[model samples]
Target: MPSSPARPLHLAGTSPVHALPPEVKIVAAFVAVFAIVATPREAIWAFAAYLAILVVVWRIAGISARRLAPRMLIELPFVVLAVLLPFAEGGERVTVWGLSLSVPGLLAAWNILVKGTLGVLVSLTLAATTPVRALPGGLSRLHLPGIVVTVITLMLRYVDLLVAELDRMRIARIARGDDPRALHQIGAAARGVGGVFLRSYERGERVHLAMLSRGFTGTVPLATAPARPRDWTLALLPAGGAVAVAVAAWWV
Candidate 1:
């Protein structure tokens, strides 16, 4: 059962990371992830350097490792898949204890697990610092397609409304003595989902009509002021760190 209203993944903080502009955070997060991906997986020292950079960012952001761990379960399925690689992969093998594992597979597994985890961590760090409401405006400032930003902004805006609507419907069903977990209730659940979709579409149509009445155009302009030069300068620290690490990583 959903207990509270839906909110963004953001955690409140007044750290310097939190003060950074959204576009900068988005770009910095991407740069860090790409740096991690581009580094040769065989270069373990490079990964260590990349992690050190992330740890520094985390400290600046006032985010703790324990706080990031549960949010990182999104990468769990990939980790499970990577864990199987050593067993399923074939070729030169090494024995640890009594069990033999493929060397190439072990390396491949390590690459997947490390890079995937790092990517998620960086993403979480970005989200932790940036408020959800600012994201679309940031994307717009970054010169992303207007349609794409509009769509995402609208989606985020309506997600909470839809969740509340669904919760109400669920409560009504339960009050009628319906058991959603029962075999017969499976069809009801499917139908409920379909109903939510239909209702959501109808609401969207009404919202569109309202916007049209208000002289809405193809794109609604964001009210946020653009990032200043100082913001950009501060933003580059994370990106610069990532680049320097990548350079040193490849050099060694």
Candidate 2:
């Protein structure tokens, strides 16, 4: 495999974490997420331990907190929900600065914000270290349903194509004096969206027909990459750390 496939969000790097196979990273990422989800909200220190674990993994991967922080803004909607929960949820109200808030709701909000942010960061770490090309293989290795794999494979392949088609349509509309920015052109905007959807559907039908004619099997075949020594061992380290965190949360 190339040092880095030129896929969106795949940061090219020479870190040890980058060298690990995609399957390992995927499993490790999921393990860390599971650990976070299993942890009790009261065990705040346990969440801190999980953050430290991620920081260590990030360092090993040559990723920085700065790089991951901005991307985590995608969790803003969840953050908003978290903020609202303290006010909207009902239980054991406490007054703060003349404002009534529920104690349990505050805890629930904190749980959502902290755990959700950590989950986003973990996923971003995996994406930074692994390219999209490797994802299908990794998922297949984990014995994901063939239908699931097939759907993801197709999406990965054609998302860019669909985007390009959309861009071309936008440019053509502009050339024809269709003001996309004009408040008066809402109908045009809707038609453009409808056209893109119809075109995409037609393209998918054609592709499916072509595949069937070409002896396309229902499932995408998994690549048989030979095993590399110590890959799983290295990969499992983070997962083990996550498990340890969970154990500490429960016992301590």
Candidate 3:
């Protein structure tokens, strides 16, 4: 059997999570994140339950901690802010480890760190299982606005081209004895960014014209197979569990 080509952020797998329809996975991820965000920050146990729910999904998806832990670092900026909040925020003070901290600040920090981490994990899970090309079809199935879907689809398709263009510019700068990494070269780097933007806009216009010539409508045709009723139920199980945990957190 021929191997499938690898795409960025997508891990090819034979797990049931990989087999799920894109639309179902999208909806499931959204619901899970919503549940996580809606849960009270003071309910510390609820965050643990949310993490447990994600772990179960990760297990079924064949994703290991090794694969996800590094990606979780993307939330480091939020973590930094969270770390400072207790010291910087003013409210009722409490002592821990010889440092006096604001009670409300501690809660606020916990809120940011926990919610941000859970949200990022949910998104990573979705991206790992779903192909980049399948995202448009999923959004369309969800009945998102046509223009919004169209914009996202085009952005995904062309973002790589813009990145490549930027790389070429960087190489050119290096060849011309200009160090893009130097502090003084910031202006040059900014100018390069502006140039890439102009090039992208022009390319978009050309592509739009080409698409129009081919009788392209506002919405792209979805070639994705429609998901079954069972698919929806199976995909939604985690989200349902999350909702239950959140409600119980509120009630207790």
Candidate 4:
């Protein structure tokens, strides 16, 4: 389970990015991601321009590449798979380093790598700048399915509790002389995972019962209000930049 900190995503500051309405930022992020995805795989210069725009946003949002670097590393596996495409994809082959590689396959791989990186970068920027609580509300306001938003909200709320419980269980196992690092201890680890699931399920049941007793409705009320004009302008900037890049990539 993913860990959740007690504090929401909003950091202490009056940055312009933070001041923008959540809805606008959400839409802008989506537009940027879509533009990145729609760009041609062979359009290397276009990706460079897209990345440059992201860098500007990062600076405006007071986020640093050093902070985002580790997070971006999570995409390495996908990047590696993309790197393999040239060899795996069948097409007209040319000899390189005594091995045949397909031209079309290589281009396909490039496409996935560039687009995937751009998509992840755009999403990371949004998450780094926007509060997690505000995200669900923004999505809801954007006409996303209510149930989907509710599920996300609940998951975010309970994920920390689950993590704490798992930590306690791990400590108990260690105190009992259980060595999870041992090859033979795989079964023990599996059982530990099962126990965590069981405990989480029980906790969920209890929470539901408590909510019912308190007249809890399925909806979680969000504090986010409507988008202001300034918010629209700020959000529009990124979207407009994305469109400009796309047009340049297509025609220039």
Model 1 accuracy (lDDT, Cα):
0.83
What does candidate 3 score on TM? 0.93
Supply candidate 2's per-residue lDDT for 57.
86
Alpha-carbon TM-score of each model against the true structure: 0.87, 0.86, 0.93, 0.87
Q: Estimate, for each residue in 1-252, the C-alpha lDDT of model 2 and write its tens digit.
A: 222222345677998899888888888889889989999899999888888988898888788787777678789999999989889999799998999998998999999998998899888889889877788888888888877887787778787777777789889989998888998988887887898889878888898889889998876666657336598889888889988989888898
lDDT (tens digit, per residue) of candidate 1 on 61-175 = 8888988887888998999999899989999999978889999999999999999988898898888888888888889889998778878887888887788888888899999
Better of 1 and 2 by TM-score: 1
TM-score, structure 1 vs. true: 0.87
Off by over 4 Å in 1: 1-8, 167-185
Q: Pick the candidate with the highest lDDT.
A: 3
Return the clash pairs for model 4, or none. Answer: none
Q: Considering TM-score, which of the candidate structures 2 and 3 is the better prediction for this target? A: 3
Model 3 scores a C-alpha lDDT of 0.89
Off by over 4 Å in 2: 1-7, 168-187, 223-229
Cα TM-score of candidate 4: 0.87
Best by TM-score: 3
Q: How high is the lDDT of residue 122 in model 3?
A: 93
Q: Model 3 over residues 109-185: C-alpha lDDT tens digits?
A: 98999899999999999988888888899899989998898889889888777777788999999999998779999
Off by over 4 Å in 4: 1-12, 95-99
